[model samples]
Target: MHPTTPRIAIVGGGLGGLTLARVLQVNGIEATLYEADINRHIRLGQGGTLDMHAESGQHALHEAGLDAEFRAAARPEGQDMKLFDKHGTLLSEQATDEDDMDRPEIDRGVLRDILLDSVNPDSIQWGKYLKDASPLTGGQHALHFADGTATTCDLLVGADGAWSHVRPLVTAAEPDHSGVNFVELSITDVDRTHPAIAELVGRGSLYALGDNKGIMTQRNGDGRIRTYVAFRAREDWLTMYGIPFDRPDVARTVILGYFSDWAPELTDLIRYCDDTMLPRPIMQLPVGLTWASKPGVTLIGDAAHLMSPFAGAGANLAMRDAVELAQAVTENPGNLPAAIETYEKALHAYVLPVAEIASHHLDLMISPDGDKQMLALLKQFDAMAAQGSGGDR
Candidate 1:
């Protein structure tokens, strides 16, 4: 697919985009990245701890030669997970001891920092939010940006996420909303600022459940913790609930009101939480989200298959796609057509099961009546805990 080098442009600066750029560079292929954000540091990138799986997410990091850096940011103790009822009774536990566990935890922001540091700054062009792109001539495409800037590329890759601009080049599809709407809020410096909430949350992931509502919280690095308060609602409920979308205090109030029936220890997170409340409407592409061929354009990560975070495989699957696509290009020396075909074929087969698992799990997590689903998770957690002490091991 190249005479020494391919004039490639990668759209997006998320994990999958950076992984592709880093891995391709390792193989001596140069690719430029276009990002929508103003700059890396300006983007907070804050969130919960991502449990980097052994064979998928971690393997991709190793392939990119960023494993040592990843370890530097890993929090082994954060892999410990707990499930509980609305009344705050412990149902089960996993990764209890945190020893011999391979799936280490890292804050989303820290993980992004490691990926960004691995790549040369010159490789990324920030604030290039794309509005439109078109095929030019002889394997080239012109990119039109929101800022009215333009550039051309010999090969374009879409790592832009679920709402990818590059996806339409290959297929006709978009992300559909998953049933759950997540009201995400955070508690800063839990060990110091909010000791009671920290005690309620402990050292790992927390799942407090009821029939239709639930809360998932996890301790993040630097004495901070992020919590997702989940509710099953129509797509428009976020606005209907008067969640001040931008102000943290307004969002905090809206989310707290949902769980007003619960204990003060649980609802206290809202009162003491940082005001940055954001409504996350869970969305995903089709389960078997595959697209037909078009020249010089392909996708990875959420852009390819954005599923619910139920099975916790969104990042894992995206990393898998990057590795597979890279191998396809690296393997097929001459025929670009053959390379893309092979990559797409393999990706379709590989992602279907995970997508199905993701869909099924989303249903359980956001069901109209979630009790049966909560019971299922409790049973699974107990089973896993009985088999192994901590999720880390």
Candidate 2:
């Protein structure tokens, strides 16, 4: 390793941070990754499935030389989607062909494993929680960790996620509640134990929305059906509503009470879910968020632009960010400041339009006529795709 080469340190082991490490390694540039988890296996069951878009997630994997592995684990069938109203009336459905690889789905854990395995294991220092980062002279920063240890890096990349400790170093903007909350539930072994629910959800996703609420479900690669019971409510609704989330049975009843008027088939999901539930308040940083580029410091993924997942672009964008940042670093050898400036400029310009679209979709998804609006939006997207294909031909 060249002594003048930047000593890069990435904070976070998420797809973005891991991809950055992998891509940099592929280009013969090494970056140390600091992950809060004890190890890779600890977060195996935390995240749900992710659909890898062709231009972003898949592209990043290709750059990291993991394309073949991703294809082997990818589920093209998971592209299928069924949209319905609260009455169980199916509004729209779309199925992908077996060869449809444009946006194949892969479990989040699986993708993370692939990235984690590709990098040099020794480069990743697991169980290192970043408590703070202070700037030092000569474009360096001192990383203070939770375990009373400190390290210095010539380049600091904050991939630490939404509540990032590194974000304050660049911007004071914080994530705001999007007025929507999700109660996540799961049903394991769905094929044998809950065939009916399996059939209802099809091979991919099920979205039932109305009355400013929704019941969304997705089929995971692990033979589990994960569901998100969404409500357009105050950020504190979970606590103020008096849902005994600690007790699964009582919590199910309390959750179902909110959806009393919905169809029985839809309510069955909440009733049959496992004894675990998580309340997530949807949050997003101000769209078009940008900051002055701090020398030797930058951020990617959720730590950079925390947006609602309604547009399904969060993971894809994060991976793309990693790819671009890696390219900038590799292309501008011995000029860490120039690399940071280039990456930040391109990132700010690229994410603004996508962030606006995500915000718009969030509003449409949680509205009273969300099901109808979503169906129409799907049709519009299909028409645009067809026109683009025809033009290419």
Candidate 3:
């Protein structure tokens, strides 16, 4: 190691942070990662499958030299999607074959594990939750951890998610609720235990929207089906509506009551959910969010621009940001501040348009006529496909 190699510290062990670390490693730049989880297993069931975009997520993997590994674990079948209305009437479906590798899907946990395995294990310090970062002399920052430990790094990267502890250092913006919340439920062993749901979900995902509400389901790699009952409601609807999600049967009944007028096949999703349920409020930072370049400090991913999932660009953009930042650091070995400034300049330019599109999609998808609008959008996509110009879904 060079004696003056920048002492880099990354907060958050998500795909963005891990990708940054891996990319830096490939370029012979060492960085230490601080993760909140005790170990990898803590994130085993964190999120659903992710469809890595060719231009972003997969590009980062290629930069990190994990393209072959990603291909081995990627699922082309998971790209299939079925769109329906509340009446269980299928509006449009996108069927994918084994060779459709443009946007292959991989379980979130699996991708994280693959990245973790590739990075130097000793470089990652697990169980270290960031408390705060204080600017110091000489363009460095002091990172204070919740466990009463501290470290000083010449370059500090906040790859943390929406509720980032590091975001306050660079930006004052906070994540605002998008007037939508997801009540998550799951059916384990869907293939054997719930054949009907397994068939309905197919190999990928299903979206059934109507009456300003939606029932969305995604099939997981472990024969589990994760479902989200989306509601365009107040932030406290879960408590105020008296869903009693703690009790499995009662919660299922109450949840189904809201969708009683919908088709029976759609209601079956909520009825068969396992006892575990989680209420997650959709939140996003103001679109076109940008912060002045703080010397020795910067942010990426949700820490920078938190947006709704309707655009399906969150993870993709995160990994893209990671790659660009890593390249910037590698290019300016003698001047980190310059590298950070260049990265932020390019980042703001790139994320603003994507964020605007995501915000627009969120509004349209959760509106009262979401099903109708979504159907129309799918029709346009079908037309594009027919013309052989549908590059990516």
What's the distance in Å from true for residue 156, model 2? 0.2
Best by TM-score: 2
Top-lDDT candidate index: 2
Which of candidates 1 and 2 reaches a greater TM-score? 2
TM-score of each: 0.92, 0.97, 0.96
The lDDT of each candidate is 0.79, 0.91, 0.89
Considering summed lDDT, which 10 consecutive residues are worst modelled in model 2? 384-393
Estimate, for each residue in 146-188, the C-alpha lDDT of model 2 and write its tens digit: 9888999999999999999999999999999999999999999
Off by over 4 Å in 2: 1-3, 389-393
Please write out the lDDT profile of model 3 over residues 279-371, one tens digit for every residue. Answer: 888899998888889888889899999998877889989999999999999998678888999999999998988888787776777778788
lDDT for each residue of candidate 1 in 1-393, tens digit (9 for 90 to 100): 445356778999988898888888877777899999989977775567788888788999988898889877887888777776666667667665555346777887888888888888899999999997888766578999999999987678899998899988888888887777887878788888878889878878877777578788889886888888888887778877688877776667767787777766667766787877778888889888777766677888888888888778778778777788777777763555667788889888978888887788667766544545767765765678888853321
Off by over 4 Å in 3: 1-4, 385-393
Clashing pairs in 2: none
Off by over 4 Å in 1: 1-4, 245-253, 368-372, 381-393
User: Candidate 1's error at 202, in angstroms?
Assistant: 1.6
